[model samples]
Target: MNPIDDMDADPIDVASHWCLQLADGRLQGDALARFQTWLDEDPRHRAAFDTVARTWQAFDASPAAPSLMAMREEALSHYARRQSRRWRRPAGMRRPMLAAVAACLLLAVAGWGWIQAQPDVYRTGLGERQLVRLDDGSQLSLDADTQVEVRYNHDRRQLVLRQGRARFQVMRDPLRPFSVSAGDRTVVATGTEFSVELLAAQVHVVLYEGSVDVLPRDAATSPPPSASPPSPSTVHRAREMRLVPGQELVAGIDAADARIREVDAPRTRGWESGQLSFNDEPLGQAIERMNRYAGSHVLATGDVPSASLRISGTFTAGDNEAFVEGITGVFPVTVREEGPRYVFVQRPGTSTPEEKMTTQ
Candidate 1:
């Protein structure tokens, strides 16, 4: 069989080979044209190339490039010595050596393939985030302190969001359905780009592209209540809430009706760029978001009207001090230390407590 057959069978492996060739800076004329043809032949080719390019860009931007380059050089030199000795080995040994080399190359280019081939749990620590590309071409961007359990089968793809938020870009698969379960709520889609956030007692689903059906697990089994409600049967039916692009569905704990609203999808994912954007968001809710990135906690205190006031701005994630300063600067509020937690209340002369010490 031709060596190129292996590459033709797996586009990501081929993309990795081409990426290495491009790194050598020797691709020209006919070679570049052939590469372009390969990319244009299939959509998977372009996706693989984009993934490889992003990996290269990340490596270039990282501070550990020097040590990583040194490791690469050492690995290459060792491989060269092995190649020189391989020809002298027995015929049986030669096949194993070639297979080992192929496996190593595949492992290098598509590490995520091996990871997603089996059931796996991916998680991120406090203030940390992760980008994961699954074997089916779906990508998951997990936010800080998030945990997800992934299980893929021939029939369907399933993910359980144990905690925190995640942005999912799912590839279309007609035969298999993709679903994410957060608490009792499950958001199902064939192919879509969306985000699911699990808060203390709420599950927020934001759709950036395509459509998804957000339903409760016990929707079908439960009957509609007899009380004189505004929407009689909407709450009992789970498939009622279908989200399109730029639409968000907020499902509160034990709440019959979910609130659906329009939002700026890009701004909703500002955490991906290490920033947070709020557009007239509640002060309490804003503080809770900041707390997700900060080790220290901040809470709203007293019957302060400012706690429910609308706040709008962008701030760097994990900068608790700057967030407090911004709050005091704009809203009529003051920050005070209450043991381990920071309390936000209405400014002095009100019923709320006076500021003991300012953050900044």
Candidate 2:
């Protein structure tokens, strides 16, 4: 019998019935509307539903879930046999008794699930990208050579970016703030679109929409006594910095300070579409971004003074030849082919025979 049919049924029973119906994807159309009406009929209805949902989530996440489920099925089977052999209880009594048994079993299973929920790890190889849809409806877009680990529980949603870059479309859950930790910094948001990149010794955060707080991962801890007092800029870097849309924050890994500036946020995610946009970005950094997609790396020797020179433009990712041509065309740089690798060097004052012939 449907638990909802009994108007006198316990709210938990009704809620559990609704949860099962929803989990099986059977509630739709008028039935879904009826469920909504029931939820709104009493404040207790929503609370009961949330409780049952959380309990089920916990139970499912338990490491011993399969064994517990098997035990539950066996107990239910034994109960059914005993009921068949004895005098039948009234329908009202039967429903409540069954609910009590199920509730007890769920509570027992939940104890194990609540202790730990396994984290999910995601990674992308060189020249590959990945899109992930989390259980809470948040989305993650990972760039090539990226890795992240995700862990979700009733109290919080947490992720750690071990390397590379990723864009996040976070779901709003005030009860559970979403946080991503990259290096020494952590980005916290409720509902926002942003990207975090771990580039060499720097961590870059770009906020495209909504707001976020970038703070030190261990803000509560004090530095050791042997350490010198921080500079004013370092003090500012240690405090939480709130970011609005279209702003970017760059924090150095080993340094004590950070920089925040306005940026074209949308253009920063151009790598998602195979287009890399650089706006007065250092040539060394641009080469690093390009190398994520290139099979043969493009190297700039330390002697190449132009390596620190800034370049600006959009270029196709992985097209190393085109990037080389573009760099040589504008900056005082020239390319030398070394097997599969391309090396950039400072251009000579006089044109070489090959350069003169090509120009002619």
Candidate 3:
């Protein structure tokens, strides 16, 4: 095998390969140490590793984890299952590792029962977001600390945004309307582009491409405690708010206001382009957005007056350390690395207004 294939691969791909190698117990001593050192050298490395780590952890936590791992040791078992050509087809990605894992998931689970089963979950942890392209060519971008369950069937495509935020680009399929359930209501769409941010206290929706229906799932909806809980309450709109392209809707089950606004959808949904921009956005909002692209913990403590005391700029989240530094520069804050656990944000006084005015 080519030892340096990694050098030419995308950095994230290389990181994912390193993680897979580590998980397979292939690296040891110096090589492993070097990988570890490289991972620690930059915030982006940590973010990439963490992405795979969390996915692996989630897979491990599932009921089928053990069986999947067991297949790794079996001799030509996955191959034999594939050669059971009488069955017509088997599960597995074409890639070797993926093929093995996929075949194991199928065989160990007693064959072809859970096809594309929303992974039992699809999630993004704190300071991370992931974009997954569905089999139907629709795009789904998950926001930080998000968990959702997807059940796409012949009749309809359904998603339960259990927590966090997500942007969806639906493929044109009039037969199977796409629906998202959050808070008390469900956002139903047809060949449309939209996003949903399911929060503990509220929910927000933005429309980009096509039209979507916003209605309640349950009558007396309860706010989500967090994003990962199974089957949270629904959110119903007291009034119908039609949002065309470039429109945004904010729904709060607990609060009195659930309104849709005319805003720049591109600016709000800019993570897809690998660029995150803040325009007089609150410290909390900026931190929330930053956390999506980087594995860092940022908070504003000690008398955060209001959202107007905001920061504005554009930065690539793939470069987390610089992103955080660029952000903290506007504030009277210091950024420090904390032993792979967190990135601390300490404010000396208050962020300066003049500093906030600097354009990126």
**Which tens-of-lDDT digit does each residue in 1-360 have in candidate 1?**
211345434554566556545544444577776777887888998897676555544444562688645644444344434334543543233446544543444344444343336567999987899999997999999998899988987678888899989999999996888888887788888899999988777788889998887768555223222333222113343344677788788887666668777788888999998887776666666666777787565455445554356677788888878887777776567767877677776776755423222221
**Distance from true position, residue 334, model 3, in Å?**
4.7
lDDT of 2 by residue, 1-360 (tens): 455876866676677666556544566778777887998899999888776656555555672687756654554454444444433543233556655656654653343244245578999988899999998999999998899999987678889999999999999998888899999888888899999999877899999988888778875122212333222222244466777788788888866677778888778999999888887666777778888888565555434544356768888878877888887876666777877678877677833222210110
TM-score of 3: 0.52
Error of 1 at 100 (Å): 33
TM for every model, in the order presented, reads: 0.58, 0.61, 0.52
Ranking by lDDT: 2, 1, 3
> Which stretches in model 3 have alpha-carbon errors above 4 Å?
1-120, 124-137, 143-145, 199-202, 219-237, 296-308, 318-320, 332-358
Q: Which candidate do you rate higher for TM-score, 1 or 2?
A: 2
Worst 10 residues of 1 by lDDT: 224-233
List the global CA lDDT of all models.
0.69, 0.73, 0.61
Backbone clashes for every candidate come to 0, 0, 12
Best by lDDT: 2
Best by TM-score: 2
lDDT of 3 by residue, 213-327 (tens): 6666652122212222111122323434445677677777655456666667778877666677765556556666666555444433234443434667777765566655665
Candidate 2, pairs of clashing residues: none
